[model samples]
Target: MNIAKHMETIFLASVVIVGATSMASAAVARIGHAAPEPKVYAVAVEGAPMAVVTVSAKRLSAAEKAAL
Candidate 1:
């Protein structure tokens, strides 16, 4: 019924819950039961910028020629 005792009980319960969760995680990792790898068709190179230019050199649009 005491406040101190109630807080102590709640703190002990939280410690036990966290310990159980950590133990479960360690067991799963030991058994190699982890998240599956994502399927990727292509891998992009690092620090490469992608550009999509659709304007022709000779047949440029009026807007594109003005912008250039």
Candidate 2:
């Protein structure tokens, strides 16, 4: 029947599209996988003397924040 032929054509087209997309995605995946290995970088942090913190410190105003 004509309907069967049409259905066959649609199914074939969808299969072709899916196959093409899967191949393209596989190629893209391979290319994406070729990234350079990340090296561990050693950061030199200088030790700063820490002072004792107390709740007796005065709260700064908005003007103080802007100046700092």
> Which candidate achieves the best lDDT against the true structure?
1
Cα lDDT of model 1 by residue, 1-68, tens digit: 68786998899999999999999989888998668899998778889877578865588799998999
Residue 19 of model 2, lDDT score: 100
For candidate 2, lDDT tens digit of each residue in 1-68?
A: 68776998989999999999999999999888687898978655679555567788888999999999
lDDT of 1: 0.88
In angstroms, give how far residue 25 of model 1 lies from its true place. Answer: 0.8
Task: Output the TM-score of candidate 2.
Answer: 0.43
- Model 1 residue 48 CA deviation in Å: 19
lDDT of each: 0.88, 0.86
Error of 2 at 65 (Å): 53
Would you estimate the TM-scores of all the predictions? 0.42, 0.43
